[model samples]
Target: MNTSLKTILTASVASLFPLGAAQASEPATSGQPDTVLIQAKKISAPNVDGTSQAAALSASSDSAALLRDVPGVSLYGAGGVSSLPAIHGLADDRLRTQVDGMNLISACANHMNPPLSYIDPSHIGSIQVLNGIGPVSNGGDSIGGTIRVNSPDPEFAMAGEMLRKGQAGAFYRSNGHAHGVNLNATHASDAWSINYAGSLSEAGNIVAASPFKVVSQGNGGKPGLAGDVIGSSAYKSENQSLQMAIRNASQLLELKLGLQNIPYQGFPNQRMDMTGNRSEQLNLRYKGDYAWGQLEARLYHEHTRHSMNFGDDKQFWYGNAPGMPMDTEGKNSGTLLRAGLPLSERDQLNLGIEYQRYRMNDWWSASGTGMMMAPGTFVNIADGQRDRFGMFVEWEANWNPNWFSQIGLRAERVSMNSGPVAGYNAMAYGNPASPLSVPGAFNAANRQRADHNLDFTAVARYTPDSSFSIDGGYAMKTRSPNLYERYTWATSNTMVMNMNNWYGDGNGYAGNLNLKPEIAHTLSATFDWHSANPDQWQFKIAPYYTDVHDYIDAVPCSAASKICPGRKDGFLNLSLSNQNARLYGMDVSASALLLSTEKYGQFLGNAVLNFLHARNKDTGSGLYNIMPLNAKLSLTQHLGHWNTTAEIQMAAAKTDISAVRREMTTPGYTLLNLRSSYTWKQWRFDAGIDNLFNRFYRNPLGGAYLGQGATMGQGVPSGIVVPGMGRSLYAGMQLKF
Candidate 1:
């Protein structure tokens, strides 16, 4: 440990106890507690409000990064904007993410446009994370948790009066020379209101400063030289949205339109980078209050166009390789309707129906001569479609003040189909008589597939006293495979296999048509302890376990199938299959008020710990890309209009990894972070320094390093792990009027 870092930590901890006794008798804050609670599933759920949102926005522009502080949540970084979030060790498409009640699907084969990337943090008004257990009304196509993000609520003025308000904010960071700006404006009258929000952000290449030695055999043997600046990691993007609302005596209607454009963005983990992306979305909703009950209806549609290719640093690796550019287009639309009714004085019933349809096409254009047997060849998924219809019913009961319970059930029907796929010059590729050329057999074998899925959930909470509570939940969840998992036809050519690179494992993959839907059974429990005083101390611990039947995994392809391409290296060409798996984890969090006084202000301390264990039931192998045991601790101080925070993040060495996937181990390390903010009138200022000591380390779940610098002939180790970001200083300011 660094001496300066030790001194700062000791001084901060030593100064708190002396004032603890004196402040215990002092009064608390002047207003209500700074916690907002929402009633959902017959329980009180905490809401991430404006203050927390502001702090998150000031830290990073990526929306997924904001969830890192949440218990039972972890991140798998692939690029500056394409980081995937995981819950209980399930990640990527396994989790359901909804923005403003719209289900947005990724348009790129490499998953460059995740659901969270659709909205900027500046436009988010509230976020709710339903940890492993969620209501059936949200969605049924995923076994993991659900994340719901909502835009700001519309404002209304008094009768015969009008109101206008606006806000502007900007932030800049030194690590990648990243900068961004956001603006929002609104006007409201008694019956109608309109609002607009927009943002723009850009960043240069990131520099890795970790000094850890490289242990992988693939990267060139330059031991400590793998942490140099990563190439093709720059990006720029813009987003805008408009919302209109109208209200009568007992009914409200709203319409929203959103647009996004990204000229270029690079991925350090995948084989290709995003050259361009453009998207548009429209959403409409109606809410009414009637004597019978409450009614709500919603409809939404989204379209996206995405393109990918090699970046400047990697273009030479191919040296004029033809058919270099790949493109994808996607359209997603859905409708939802729900009603709430009171069955009795102590019971309530809620019913809802949802429908979603997704269409996608992936194709690559050939460039240069002598590369393709024909003039133009497109070797990717074509005209792929997946549709889902779901209905759910939930019952909530308040048996007594000490007991609250909820039970829900959902049914979903999923159907998938795709057009015929073809490979270039069938005869030249050694499959002249086979269906590899036109893929006619492939189309006929998997033309249309359908699955009927069901889900059930039961949860209860017991409060023995005002300061103690216990919650327990059990759920049975199911998920159908995505389009790419079932429609990507196999090919002997490795180039075609490499096109389906979503996991960043540096291996080729093909889809399987005979895959079964994954089913998961989960049980979770939480224990909470709090002081009678609201501002004193609180602690919570949650433990969860999940058993997955037919879990998706990669398996080796047989030579007779002609689907596996022979690679000179030891890596194997694999395809998707179903296997059994089990996962268990625990999340612990605690917060305490160390001091509170009229003269000295307030001081608080917080800590969080997360652990996970996942394994394949049949093979007894650890799951790939599982997060290591990690913990975070922070101290916060507030005086007058100024606030400051000091944080320490630590992770244990990862020794349990998937041997089949050739996963590497990472050493444990610690990082320090600092932040401060000040407020005056309608303006606020924020500043922060991340990786304060500039300690160098690699994240266990950051994925493998696939940049050109790590290539076999590039001078650096070919299999070096991706390193974490270097030290960074950032500042921001916001004004509201």
Candidate 2:
């Protein structure tokens, strides 16, 4: 790593230790660096900082892939940038993800524009993952966890001085013919400062390993196999942001504006691809310190216009399916206020209020020559709207040096409404007298729904000495269904519910009006052991369990229902519902200095292990798309201005799968990766080769291969497992001034 990058990594690792006892003292100076911490009080939850984020972004083009190695966290591959993250088998809307204190909603029905895709990796200052458990004040309406991505803080010059700084970098990769560039510049004065960042990236179809092949049957009854390419997996995107900050004696105010444009992107797992995406965002924030304590307030808004349609690959699969063009628009706005107060010498309290409003519409245009009509069909989710308001209070106390505890409570109200819906051949499934005519009845009735939910958390830490500690927590979390989950109104039997296809099961589905909220009860514990010196060696282990009531699932629909069109795969029609579920998992990690010498420098070793088990308790069936047991081991060496690392990643075969969904099984494989860096003055260079051995493997959670370019053997199933990437070489250079 470069000297500057090495400094950042060191600082991030040091932050994992206890603040007062582990941090080294620094000499007072006239100029100080800008820093921001975003946790609620002191809690005993397992969390991972941004070190992994920095490493992953440096090596790959997708930001969501960064979480795959984090303990207790896994990824559901959907596209290059739209991968959905899962914790303990829960994913998508079940988790809360925010960028710079703003929550962004995806406008595409297939979720082509997830929250993480809105922020470029070059502008990310920090990323924090609260695994399994999170403070009530930080988030609500989530049972999984929270992911926070923050931009670099604005900087102001010291008294009687002005400062200017900037950095430029570029990178290229082989397997996908991918390349990208990023630039950042900032100017600061005594009272005001300005900052700007921009990035551009593009990639072609990804190449699979040589041993991995896609067998397809052509229109002529001839079967053919293709090698080393997953077609239609291309994308291009651009992002830009500007920020301004004003500072006074004890207060600071900041404003930011961001713009994003994505002309096209392919999804190998979804039925439709992203043809266009344009978005704009504005945010305003204030931070102040007073006699009572500290206060932070923020207001933000985001708007997105997205379009999706069948790409060339898809057009080849379904030749005369008509040009299915769909357009969607979304508007999101929110406000937050939080304050901290000191009650006494040993007690403190934090309180916050939050509110958000969201609106969305989805409609599709006909090809002018389709099966039933000439003009078009509308109302996938006409005039869909959701509003939420929440309040939370938390208290932290230090009974003594060895014992610290925190307790918090949160309450929220969620409301949803939508206008009338209509589709092609509505009358076929819309008979009002039929018991299965919910879709038709919903269109006739004005739909309005509301839910009141509550959550609580209690955590404590016990430490007898500086080298060891025991921490534990218990939490109750709740989440109501999203707008799409309750308001997707389409009568086409073959219209697979794309929003709910995160698992890539290749099943058609529809929404339910009577679905209830999911409530989760969880308990977690962690044990930490470290050397007395606090810098040589360390080990940490965490175990967690959760039981959820009314967990979301899919079940067979009645044959007479309007949406019960059978698919080509011969699977029965399905609808969303709630069932009881259980999940338990454990994470183990360790790091140590193996050797140190003045002549050879330092050598370090690190390892991690993760395992999880999930099941639908009510039906005695395994959960879909759960990650198999996995582990990773790595070694690092530093000498003079050069740094190098070697790593091995391994996973066990997965057989446990949901019978109803007909989930596929995968065989295990191991991979090797190597990376190195060199720095000189203000210039740095990095190079790495992933999958060094050119190994061919299948990722159990990688989702099914729905790409149209590939052909399958006659009578072969459609749910073929997608293969991992082939060997690739990457190089990057950065210059700072």
Candidate 3:
């Protein structure tokens, strides 16, 4: 689908939202130390302080919330700690998200744990989000853009001195009885540094403003969920990490070890909950500065062991089947080598080489202690493997002070293969097509596939003066289908398809073997108007349009995939397909210093408005899970060591929906959030209230409500949208020692 310039201009009234701007910078070849900011492009975090108190004090435990203020970014509602971030209407595997320089893949079928979930906010030193026009050397195999979250660097003491520092913080939120604690400690000398960071967070079911749906009664005398409560919304997660750094005058060596344990996490939209998930990671990196260029090399390995079953909110007994349990195991390892070479005084070149290998296994165990789901083990995915090799070269030129340009090209080769799979039994499971037979067909079909993708980006930044600037560019990006999008078999089995859904839309999805890589062409520009001084006043607007080919969507499945037909207002069973899509949007953001006086205090105001339109050109239907028109406005006051902010958030009613997915619509609503913080030397305290009025509203990206009941076989009714939080009070305190 090629969206014309006329079409984009036609939708200008309600189309675009711009947040902020990024300045293209020439890469440093020499005269500087090698840092994580060695790429051809430079992108800053949301604020001066990365993962600031505002994020830690918020009621939500999801660290992805830190990107809420960034332009062209939104989140898909998931578990308490795992929210999938969407960039310019593209999400999940479509975005390249890196954590501590490692490209992590979601191991679970439901995608309950995304990359951001691995690192707690307290451990973050910086977060940067780049839209589609980012330089090719930033990353590859992605269309939406790139997100980088780097851990804090080692802080060494002065010459001949020792460094010792530690900080502890804790917070509590009322809505879901959510609470958490975080600790950070560092010990370093002038030459070496050792640091450890840890956090623990837990929450119960969240309470809605009002009763929204009637849940089913569980089997074996288990009562149904309460009306005012959103079930399967609870979670508990613990993370610990250790870092050691060794540095010389021109080189730095770092080693990081990370461990995560998510004992349990409930998903209100998915049929199953995460009962247990554990992951371990080891990362090694070295950065050096040479006469001609700066080079950085990193190698990392991660492994995940995950398990899922019915949580307390859902029914456990199903006649002979006591509980359905699913397990997934995955291993990921990758290497990244990047270098910046100076070509001349005004030009720099960045070259990158990358390799990644991932292996995964998904299987289901018989239920009821091997009585109910008899036959044998159901092998959903056996020995799945995906490997990627990529290379890119980018050039950034500083054309005087008034104009700058960046151009780059990238190429990637991705290969995937999966072993044979089998169902629980060889007999037909009451399906017209005989669900058990599909496994044989799937196993016999060609399971190995590969794709070659090429990407290009051209960006230009113009600043006529200090008060005004414009940044615009064109980007062509490509991404291959993920494992879940290409390897999920068994189209005839509704039970199996239902378990593969990651959108939480209450629909069953079966993967298709014949899928193509998605290619996207994007045109975007950001215009800025502001005062010359720092923090006085600034306004930015960005408008963007993207045309995507071979977009992964869905189509009606064979009749055999039906889930107990004749149900009223039910969900659909569909198979994945490649389609065409077009997305256009704009973002507007402004900040101004309202007042400043020594006798009083300083007051600042900030506001942002976003609008997006995405449609499947092949089907002429709106895309799924895209956020609607929304605005965020805030006023902040600073007096002495105290800071406070009052924020108002508004979202227009989401009426445009994906019919193929039976997407739900949400009503427009407004929310008020208030927070205040006080700092006293080594002590800091924060307090906030979210949804101050106890307003009732639905989450635009919440998908459907499958939080409770017999979700396995369409036992739960549809049409109920997930509700947003209401009237949550929170307080946090931190102390340094």
Candidate 4:
């Protein structure tokens, strides 16, 4: 589905219909889940101006990019399809993201495949983001907040009629010669329906406005790096899914099968690239209405086989072997049950239970026969397992016509364990003079661990009138460390440590087995004011603060550890440690009706500003990768079937960086974008020019440039920030019948 910030900021609160509230919606269900109600919905069409920007939004494959304009939301540059979203000041595993009610986890050490990359943007029906104080039922195990993405639901036909509909669309961008195509078809009777969605996307290395740094070149692609191109930024992906559903009045059952294959995908921030990734999913769901309320149950299984190797720009040979091949396999199965209970006109209760089982095995065979390449296989994570079981209860009440409240509590148990591991040359690798190999220490340590976590939240809303309302809440959340954070054992060899870096900073990391779970306490509030008629004007501001105990920050490797020694100054070896952290942020947004006339057209304006501050309270140091002050301004014009928008996006220079990591800072810059759409009959077309002025600036959060050269052990050049994309014109068309 296509979405824009204009729709989200101006959406009405009536759409907050509880999942099991009063009625049943077949294809278009309620946006808010029973236990989650932050009231931010991604509407498909642009209703703010009575027009749509489907053409411009669907031209890219990255689903995470859709949140670019969202308040307090930032993107971490990765593969073409694998960008990670950072809410507030936290990113990665800190956020609870679900796809079609399934909690999927990244199985790679480098997190090359994030949950958002599993589904294509063209197939997304709606996206809901609770970028604030979310209730416990929204989920446990995360602190950044929650995001739910769903695909279009099956549509049934009239009483005695048959239904058949299909849509096809394609898009292309001038930069990197990016292009893709999508197809979806639906067939249904009164009570039965079948739907299919498939898409293919690919792109070459993207170029910057100009060369950011000078580096060695070998692939003979372009000047500087490759036409000022970011090496290893190419990607190719295909996805297909089939869903079958049957419904009898208020009851519905569905079965969905999904398949995904990525032949090759490059990353400008990381050293290794995704050579192959194959994934399959089977999901079954049941939902029905009973006398008590609504009941829902789901069971799913997902498997992935992933491989990493040198891409087009990175070096391929390592002394003897043509390439260093790393392989990983992961299996995940989960079950969820939820029940919505109605006690009275003003009271509602939501109860849920969830259980998940995950198994993973990561290993790299001996290769190259070099100093770092031993003769034995290197087992990164052998037979690793993490199981989670949780239950939650949430209560909602409308005390009167003007006040509403919700409270939730969740409890869960997480059990993690892993088998023994061995490094290359299991015996010879251990340095007797200094200390035993980390493998020995890791194998001998007690890897089995269990954590009983609890989460609690309380929120209240007061609306004295239709023009103004205020919402405030406090949340206490808990999150256990991911498998990679506690089980990665290699630390002696820089190459091995390099393989474990997921932050894309050209640094090395090792996991700390004794790390504790992170606990966060957040306080948030939102004040909204709008004209009697929402379309006429609106304004809102939200501010939030969070304090975390045992935050997972990294510390320089100490000689006392005796495993990893000889740390380099620029590119140091580090270990994950627990530290206290605090973060605060605020979002201010305003929208207004600029002008409307029969002779001309309708004009609307919207703007948003965001500011963030984060610090490691324990060490009095700046946190890493925190987004800087940023803002967006847009003016949209609408006339009959034609719509156009001009946008300006800007960010402040980044100076508050992690001193320990020797993080590099970036200079701020601004760019303009122009987009337009036109619709006729059953067809719609969209076109846009990004970086209209061809601005040259670096992405503050893009991390170091490690896309090319010999990246095995500091041979690749560092201290270069990844450059932003240059000017590019893109266009797309869609038809429905």
Report how far residue 384 has shifted in candidate 2, in Å.
0.9
- TM-score: the better of candidates 1 and 4: 4
lDDT of 2 by residue, 1-737 (tens): 24465445445544553321211111111111111123344573454421342334457666666566566778887767667778777888788888889877777666778898887777777566775568887768888877777888888899889979888888888888889988888899989999998988888878777745445443334333355666458888889999999999999999999999988888776667788899999999999999999999999999999998766555433334455678889999999999999899889999999999999998776545544322446557888888889999999999899888888899999899987766543453344334356556777665788999998988888876676667779999999988777777554545534433434666656777777899999888877666677557666778889999999887665522434655565333567788889999888877777777889967777777888899989778888889899898877777877778888989899888887777788999999998877767776677888999988888788766766542211232466777788898988766777
Scored by lDDT, model 1 comes in at: 0.75
Question: By how many angstroms RMSD does model 2 differ from the true structure?
Answer: 6.3
Q: What is the lDDT of residue 98 in candidate 2?
A: 86
**Quality of model 2 by C-alpha lDDT:** 0.73
Score every model by TM-score. Answer: 0.91, 0.90, 0.92, 0.92
**Considering only N, C-alpha and C atoms within 3 Å, which residue pairs clash in candidate 2?**
215-711, 215-712, 216-711, 216-712
Model 2, residue 425: C-alpha shift (Å) = 5.3
Candidate no. 4 TM-score: 0.92
Task: Give the clash total for candidate 2.
Answer: 4
lDDT score, candidate 1, position 19: 31
Q: Candidate 2 or 3, higher TM-score?
A: 3
How far in Å is the alpha carbon of 397 misplaced in model 2?
0.8
lDDT ranking, best first: 3, 4, 1, 2
Per-residue lDDT tens digits of candidate 3, residues 10-96?
A: 234112212222221111111111122223343211111111334343356787876776656788999888989998899988999
Model 3 TM: 0.92
Model 3: residues with Cα > 4 Å off, grouped in runs: 1-55, 215-224, 369-372, 429-436, 558-569
User: How displaced is residue 713 in candidate 3, in Å?
Assistant: 3.2
- In order, candidate lDDTs are 0.75, 0.73, 0.81, 0.79
Alpha-carbon shift of residue 185 in model 3 (angstroms): 0.2
